[model samples]
Target: MAREECKALLDALNKTTACYHHLVLTVGGSADTQDLREELQKTRQKARELAVATGARLTVALRDRGLATEERAEFERLWVAFSGCLDLLEADMQRSLTLGAAFPLHAPRRPLVRTGVAGGSSAVAARALSARSLRHEAEGDFDVADLPELEREVLQVGKMIDDMEMKVNVPRWTVQARQAAGAELLLSGASAGASSVGGISVQERAGPCDPSKALAATVFSAVLLVAVALALCVAKLS
Candidate 1:
């Protein structure tokens, strides 16, 4: 491929790969999760295979150019390292999946209001939901002691459990929010990847799934790509 074309393809693939890695976290229990896992397996294979193929083609090209023996060996070694990229990607995926599973509930409840509304059924529903949400706010039995006797009796259940869960909830909520946002970036990422060429993208080929993860995986992938691209640029300039 030409330079720009190759860059675009690589970017699209990277984004799609990141998307799947992020998705494995939030989609673990869904019916479609296995499909996501299968897609992930396929993606890792394609990446490894592509790296090998590219390395082979480049080696042949360099050999045809009458490159020095030592230089040729070095080039082959560098390209061979691409196969290990899959291993790194798989490790990141596993780590992110574990972090995602830390929540007590596998799935978050459907949010009360996607956008808090002020009128109609949404307004009434929002009010009702707000009341329910207040239940999460009370920190201890003391906070609920002011309620009716029957309400207080029911509230004691939280005393038994709240402190233990509260510790996890704080950090988990933050992680969950970021994963949701990152997943959004990844899903829409395919179109963003395609916007330049005005055609189908790598994400489309892989198919989309319900999404979320990879603070661990996402950051690593992004950093690695930037590092690799910079190395290539430096090599070309020299």
Candidate 2:
């Protein structure tokens, strides 16, 4: 039972790691590099937390078990592998941050023009060209025109963040499996050495059934029936 529980826990841990990895990969492929980097950093942080939690659970399980030295060593080796993955994730985040920060900000162009006095025909042509240039500059300066694209990108990033957060908070079935396994392990341990386990008394294990309470409940039910019968008899008599 203990082995089964351990296997369940390990399976859950693996599933969680896989889910997190998928999120990381999806974030990596995002077109919006800035948002992607931020989301990747968040994913890495979440992965680190998961690694720590899994490590703690594994340590607890190992300590409670009567495993051979070889088994213990193998568990430690697995932990090391998990830790290495976290380290790699952290390093990747650092590299991404650096690369993102190095992206140069380009300044928006300021429209410029110079026109000297010339012949009437030339001046008229130059004025017409100037008018067209001014119209183009006005169009370019309309920041509101870009708002829909910016809004769309923002919504996309927000959806990604929301999806990732939901995945983190939702309880995985592996967790449920691990819990069931752990409960079975504890119950089996209790059954093996019932007398030696001193914390919970046997009576407590028997739960809350009481014969006196059962008798009282039975008596009350009988009395209620008799009373209803008497009332019906009185109604018939009347």
**Top of the candidates by lDDT:** 2
Question: How many steric clashes does model 1 contain?
Answer: 0
* Local error of candidate 2 at residue 77 (angstroms): 2.8
lDDT of 1 by residue, 1-238 (tens): 4323333434444555566566555433433332343454455456444533443454354445576755544444433332233344545455434433332221356422133344668768668566434554443322122223323322332342343234222222222221455777897887787685554555677676544544667888999999999999999999
Q: What is the lDDT of residue 111 in candidate 1?
A: 26
lDDT of each: 0.45, 0.50
**TM of each candidate vs. truth:** 0.26, 0.32
Residues 137-215, model 2: lDDT tens digits: 5555332233343344334434543443343332222222214557878888888777666535766787988899999
lDDT of 1 at 35: 34
Report each candidate's C-alpha RMSD, comma-separated, in the order given: 31.0, 19.6
In model 2, the Cα lDDT at residue 197 comes to 60
What's the distance in Å from true for residue 130, model 1?
34
